[model samples]
Target: DTAALMKTPLKKGDTWYLVDSRWFKQWKKYVGFDSWDKYQMGDQNVYPGPVDNSGLLKGGDSQSLKEHLIDELDYILVPTEGWNKLVSWYGLLENQEPIARKVPNAIEKEMRKLFSIPDEKEIRLWNKYMSNTFEPLNKPDSTIQDAGLYQGQVLVIEQKNEDGTWPRGPSTNKLTLTLQ
Candidate 1:
């Protein structure tokens, strides 16, 4: 249904569309759950691996256009430096920001149209789920693999330390994506 829906362009100003967020399941449990046993189911917290958007296993193949666009629009790509540029364009970057990430205004407009959020006050979305600090969503604290994001999901920036490096945590190099 998602693939069929995304195949065409949406022209209406504010229409709701399906967004994949199976990737953030563990992160949700990590931040929201009171105990490990509550969210754990076998190796559920562990990163199993990446799969195609249709829930099919895709050995070593690259992400399809649908998957890429879904990730790009959902802010699931936040861990990469590319995400910084998108965030900057969203005008969320603060003064003295470390990175200079920007894209052309025309492209930004088009992107907003495609991934239009239902709520302009997107900060509420993040606060509703996790604390203001990115510490709970930190790679070290969560340890889950990167995954697809749900609709209306806002990207949370992991604050860098005073030493000009990211906070100390286990390096989560795993990549796992799921869509539901």
Candidate 2:
């Protein structure tokens, strides 16, 4: 009869517990979660990659018009150092002849619309997925489609590295872009 007197009524999804000083830490466990500010700190890269129409993948706050150009133009040639590696690594390798095959030079208008090439620097695109080999569409009459580039593929813009060396090799760039 004494034991029955101590029994308490319970409800569904409710727990009955006898907590003490030791339970203080246990109670805090329920609140263990990340806030938006904490989640905001994420990996950032030096260069940008190809972006979607809205530029969500590139991070809306940091999305650059250069990145959007790749998505906008019909056939814009990108330089090796121009595109973001962390962004467009996988898309380029999915198609055959992933190499900068031979897009026609007529895309010059579109390419020019993207950016003006300096006398020293030529607009180029590369596959940094596993390699740093950059191919330049020197001829404006050429289209990158001939360079084995398909829709949604990415090519890095070729440029001088900090050390004044061209990005190269699987060691430096990471993988060889073997074209079929």
Candidate 3:
């Protein structure tokens, strides 16, 4: 039913069902309906967006996040300061959607190989459990999915600021790596 209704206008109560506002905005402009705000119904709450951890979703988000993430960058590799410290840069992959059902402690051993980390510093990614040997990935794991990383995305190999922020050495700095 919803699939068949995609091309047609839909309403939830008195408000218009907004599948996507950006698409609608662009759709209107491409069709020369941008100024047709009067034709556009419903409040901002009808916008569509990604679902958060609670299994709940916030609708009608335009600037904060996006949907149909196939053509976007899933994550950014940001270098930390001092030694090697990687904070979280979360963006989901393009073609390969993440397995959202998985628990928070998702594991990805290969993510370690993606980083250009020094040999001595690699252990920093693991917890200090020398004897028991029950250590897990110290790398930023949430950026990784058990299903595998997004295509063409790789790790950052730079030093971040002492406060655990990405280093912006110049007016513009972009570090991209190809996942091996």
Candidate 4:
């Protein structure tokens, strides 16, 4: 019955970007409808029930997360100072999309080079662990070897807010690091 309203028949590889309710109002004007009532009566099919998460999906159903992932750099972690300078250079905001590149095998060495950190000093990667805490990534790190990193991971250097409060360090500070 829904197919009867579509201008074109749904194809085998059809996909759609679902927008939230906040942006849904813009569709009426963009679709050239004079009023909400007219839009409601248009060729597009409407479901009366609430949207279900499992109902609409973009990619192949059989593919695993690893299969869906590309072998490219997914995230970058930079020190706050260095990040500020880099943002100034690009004239952009704090968050930006990454340009695609192959994931490096030697993440420790690569991160040191990117961070301009010394060999003796260990560079720690941090991520949000809970509501207000962040924890350092625990991986094999050394001057001579890789940090055993993989793609799709986002890590950052710890930072303190402007109110003289630490955002994500207390939890990690309490954790004891033991060497085997």
Candidate 5:
């Protein structure tokens, strides 16, 4: 009977009384039904059943009952922060495993295509930008001296930030840059 009831197709607006024994007890306690007979009589005042759309569950018609059931199930009502944390935590764990183990080579190939590295010109431009923006905090053996020209566009390197990770003392003499 319970399985048949679950299989029953519920329309947009259909009134349903609490007949399930488990739900009946909960409903009786929730509404404070004094007598079991009164609760079973399908009384409107004590146990109202109205075909309404305002409070229906995802697949049922009755907001209050649906909410009660969801609460009873200890369902996790996820907020934006919870969802973000879940995604971030999953990402951290997922990165620990190699992709080749989880997906087929076809998927790996597609991912490789999607994240293909840029050409030499793009790298030069990026290097130039890095040099101009960051002031070298320390002197370095090597400097971004020049960016070659490509497609008639000249690439110029500029001083950016001093490499903070330099092994020696704070030289405040090195320059970093990138070309466009």
Candidate 6:
């Protein structure tokens, strides 16, 4: 079904995940339809089911507080500062798709320009950090090593830690330096 959908030309009823207003506008232009109308149709919800969550669980009247404590824990543990922190760290969260596609490349380009390195020093640094940090956490028997330099100014090093263990301390860890 997915393959068929992809192969067939998009029709009026076909669903799409628009990245932003710009992409929506572009799709509207291509499809010869009013963007507002398309948005209106997309906004409409026609689910044929009870909307409320109340009284949905079995034995709802007799449910004990101790038994359901974990279920309500998420509500109590809500990080009020999380949204602000995420926005501060990652910028506006609404336009995530475009930012996800564009930001790393932009950052890499800027870093390369700032460092004035012909080779991809930034990518190497990223690879090193991932090897040291994530590979240990996720996989076994994976070792990263220095892959050599891209440009004269940059050095490409592979992770050599066999156990995939991350080094500790402030100045000694390659991952820490790369992140900084």
Please list the Cα RMSD from the true structure of every candidate, rounded to 1 decimal place: 22.1, 25.3, 19.1, 19.1, 22.6, 18.4
Local distance difference test scores for all models: 0.31, 0.34, 0.30, 0.36, 0.29, 0.29
For residue 50, model 4's alpha carbon misses the true position, in angstroms, by 39
Over 11-52, each residue of candidate 1 has an lDDT whose tens digit, in order, gives 323232221244334333433423444444434454323211
Instruction: For each of the candidates, give the backbone clash count.
Output: 0, 33, 7, 0, 24, 7
Judged by TM-score, which candidate is best?
A: 4
TM for every model, in the order presented, reads: 0.21, 0.25, 0.18, 0.27, 0.15, 0.18
**Better structure of 1 and 5 per TM-score:** 1
Query: Considering TM-score, which of the candidate structures 4 and 5 is the better prediction for this target?
Result: 4
Q: List model 4 lDDT by residue over 12-89, tens digit each.
A: 223322212322332233344344355554344542222111212233432122222221132222323333333354
Please give the distance, in angstroms, between residue 89's alpha carbon in candidate 1 and its true position after superposition. Answer: 28
Candidate order, lDDT descending: 4, 2, 1, 3, 5, 6
Off by over 4 Å in 4: 1-103, 129-131, 140-152, 158-180
List the lowest-lDDT window of 10 residues for candidate 5: 94-103
* lDDT of model number 2: 0.34
Q: Write the per-residue lDDT of candidate 6 for residues 1-180, one digit (tens) a residue.
A: 222332443232233321223332333344335534454333324211211112222344322221222212211111223323323433432313211111112333444556676553313233233333411112111211112212223323233233644243222333334454
Q: Which of 1 and 6 is ahead in TM-score?
A: 1
Model 3 spans with C-alpha error above 4 angstroms = 1-109, 114-139, 146-149, 160-167, 170-180
**Candidate 4, clashing residue pairs?**
none
Worst 10 residues of 3 by lDDT: 78-87
Which model is ahead, 4 or 6, in terms of TM-score?
4
Clashes of 3: 7
CA deviation > 4 Å runs, candidate 6: 1-44, 47-110, 120-123, 127-180
